[model samples]
Target: MRRSGCGSARVRPVLAVAVSVLVAGALVGAGPAGAADPPDRVDNPYAGARVYVNPEWADRAAAEPGGHVVAGQPTAVWLDRIAAIEGTDEAMGLREHLDAAVAQRAELVQLTIYNLPARDCGRRAPQGELSIEEIVRYRAEFIDPIVEILAAPRYASLRIVAFVEPNSLANLVVNTGSRYTATPACEAVLARGTYLYGIGYALARLGAVPGVYPYLDISHHGELGWPDNSGPMTALLLQAATTAGSTVANVHGFVANTANYSVLREEYFRADDVVNGQPVHLSKWVDWNPFVDEVPYARHMRELLAGRGFSPEASVLVDTSRNGWGGPARPTGPATRHDLNQYVDSSRIDRRALVGNWCNQAGSGLGQRPATEPEPGIDAYVWVKPPGGSDGASGQPGLGQPYEPMCDPYYNPPRGSPYPTGALPGAPPFGEWFPAHFRQLLANAWPPL
Candidate 1:
């Protein structure tokens, strides 16, 4: 339910160095250890911890051919709707998942706290069950129940990494503007301050619990990679961090590329490279964004957030669930062509038709396997968005999700330069596991499973 756009590339040099220093601090566990000072808290929640593996998702994955390869790996349990809080006939409730984690001897459990009022304003489908005026109910029903379940003494030993509201704050940054890509729904959300209230309330309540680390979602490089977008987004997030009796301490860090297909790094090209006497950032694909991929984008954003008063211990997490563009089509090296477009097209690993394509992309693969502190400044490489789950429906009947044009492989936008949606066809509604997509992900996994 995220959309994409371009931004200016103007990150200061000092901030870049700050990223390295912060990463060094994280490596040595050096810092005030603000919220992490609690007996149950640690600088990195995933360090020396076994993340929870959802039995429901594991059963689905194991049912597929060759699924055992990844079935044992951990994935986040999403509380996307109210029904999900209390176990549905087909799914486990929040407490059930936590109990299962205890049984599995998992030290860490990842939970995605989605379902803000008027959620996913940038997209037509998968709208939240709450309305704009239902913010009170969102807190009373959604956030309250989750907090109560998590506060149970039996679950206190578990290090809970709660991914707070993916696609919520970032939409307030780019989607509320007057640009052609802007939607009326996002404008209303911005005007009403719905996202800030919902996210702030969730963070305050969740962070109050010991051992709970709240990582706010900041979208990804493809969405907020530019100075114009990133600057505004940093400001908005700061505001959200402090809203509704919440402070910067309420936030542990931020997560990027949640459920979106953006490569972890671009091996062949840099954002400022000049090819054919033209800046790579100016190319159609790069679109002038300073960050060529999620790593730099996330590190730079952490720097910005720290400068804005977040704790120095605040690190970053990347959702490497998808975005590994591997398989036979994966590029080995830089393109020899002098033309800028050709060079970018051939070298980039993200095979989407456009960076804005956020649906069930066709050529994407399982990215880096979930790991602890895989990169400097990254708290963890996580599977926040479970691989093989549908981003949304592609005009499939009997699927409850509405048809979003971006999910239609044949539907091209009228305003922007026309490009394929790159969405795989016959997909089910959002969050349902798709067998074909799972098989493709397995076949193209970067580390070869």
Candidate 2:
């Protein structure tokens, strides 16, 4: 793991500089590769060719880029961060953004309902999946809504992934009929379908069976929650693998969280010139949080299995949002105040690398990942969370609140003066970073084929 006593204060200025000229977006052709098809020149967050756009919060794209998430793929809602109430979201313009994405033709709308009482997320040293209440509520709010809508045949052509939560076996086994493309990021042609496969299928591919020494990895961790380390992540992978059956599952484990939890993050961010301007993952940015980084948490299961004489491989998915925070300190989680940030640079101690960690460098364009087969343990490392979006930002100059850091382009008060460098603006609005980074990752990291 990459280790650094660095503080967020020290990072702020660097981030400013990084967000400035260092951060740019332009779509050139993907370099050269041998794995899959040619990659997109720009760094677009929705790594796959299908583009989902919401124009309410930001300006509408004048024209949908060629293969990037264009205007015709499919449009959906942005309800994941829905507020406590339907219309009570602090950022009122969100409704507009959703509408715009829909207007842009996003076939699937994503929603993350964390407001329910069940979502208490009680403080657990290693918090597992959603609390019982959260699961119940998930059914009530999400599954139920989608099932009802699709059941009614309201939109037969309206295809969507019920809940991109880590992975829901029920969702997988219950539903079948899909397209399984070799690479998750298929442009114009990378679209395939498969039927509802189950854990059995995934297990089979990994070369296992029900009674024959169970695969002891995150996949079996019934407790890991929120996708970064446990519950949701393992659950999601199993569901996908099973569902995909012998095929690569599109599991966007929480890169941010996984990176923050692991020591690997440090190595990723330390090498600024590693990938050059090309995206490390073809999408995303970087953030380091030493405390709370979940290393071996997944491997722990492997070790446990090894203790039992199983010594099986580890299976894990990561949620790489807010993870830019890096892993936790020796014993604590991310320092809320940045004073205790124990982040690092982890380049050694190699094992199965699941996904990229903490923040990717991207801008306005479609960035693509080079064609590389998944290592024994990894299925696919994708951009689950749209990049450039602030957890909650207002999307305005000099204003970073709610999560939306700086709006795309990193606009400053002075037209020509760069941001942060020149004292001329307000805090960045919430949810603003999504578009900028989403657009950039696509433009940069796309490998040359």
Best by TM-score: 1
Model 1 C-alpha RMSD to native: 9.3
* Top-lDDT structure, candidate number: 1
lDDT of 1 by residue, 212-235 (tens): 999988889888998888899999
Once fitted onto the true fold, the runs of candidate 2 whose alpha carbons sit more than 4 angstroms away are: 1-77, 81-142, 152-159, 162-377, 392-449
Q: Whole-model lDDT, candidate 2?
A: 0.27
Per-residue lDDT of 262 in model 2 = 27
Residue-pair clashes per prediction, in order, are 0, 151
After TM-score superposition, the amount by which residue 27's alpha carbon in candidate 1 deviates from its true location, in angstroms, is: 16
Per-candidate Cα lDDT values, in order, are 0.79, 0.27
Residue range 33-139, candidate 2, lDDT tens digits:
22222222221222232323323212222121322332121222234332322344333232433343234333323333222221212212111234433434444
Candidate 1 has a TM-score of: 0.90
